[model samples]
Target: MIARIWHGRTRVDDFERYSDFLIERAIPDYKNTEGFIKLVFLRKKTEKEAHFTLITFWKDIDAIKKFAGEDYEKAKYYEEDRKFLLEFEENVEHYDVFAEEYA
Candidate 1:
């Protein structure tokens, strides 16, 4: 398995709206792609910013390529993100999953 991670931030006040966009738009888009195993979104809020990290599991690199294309390390963005993001991250990180445990 492969695990892909992406991070972004929004103004603290816009946090809930950004979260809703991910649930209503981003998650569903991921579900429609081949080899998409699972995804988890984590959030942290402070007085100034709301940070988000998206962790996605896939069958392999090919699976990620289906979503990210030839430059698979590049981060993917939705049109709506431009309005909320404090800055755009150009790339994402990926790792080979060595083991797993479920609670």
Candidate 2:
């Protein structure tokens, strides 16, 4: 398995709006993509900004490539994101899922 991690930030006041954007827009797009097993969105708020991290699980690199296209490493962004995010991150991180646990 593989995990794709993306990080973004927005003004503290826009946290709810940003979360809505993720749930309403991003999640649906991800769900329709090939090889997307699941996605977990994490958030942290500070006085200045709210940070978000999307941990997306895929079956393998091929699955990710299918979802993200040939240049999969190039981070993709949605137009709706511009409304809430303070800055567009230049890169996203990916990790190998070496272990797991379910409850």
The sequence of per-residue lDDT tens digits that candidate 1 reaches over residues 4-103 is 9999999999999999999999999899999999999999999889999999999999999999898999999989999999999999999999999999
Tell me the spans in candidate 2 whose CA falls farther than 4 Å from its real position: none
lDDT of 1 at 98: 99
TM-score, one value per model: 0.98, 0.93
Q: Which candidate gets the maximum lDDT versus the true structure?
A: 1
Q: Go through the candidates in order and give each one's C-alpha lDDT.
A: 0.96, 0.89
| Model 2: how far residue 17 lies from native, Å | 0.4
lDDT of 2 by residue, 1-103 (tens): 8999999999999999899889998898889888889999999999899999999999888888877777777677988888888888877889999999999
Q: Give the TM-score comparing model 1 with the true structure, all chains together.
A: 0.98
Residues forming the 10-long window of minimal summed lDDT in candidate 2: 66-75
User: Model 1, which residues run further than 4 Å from truth?
Assistant: none
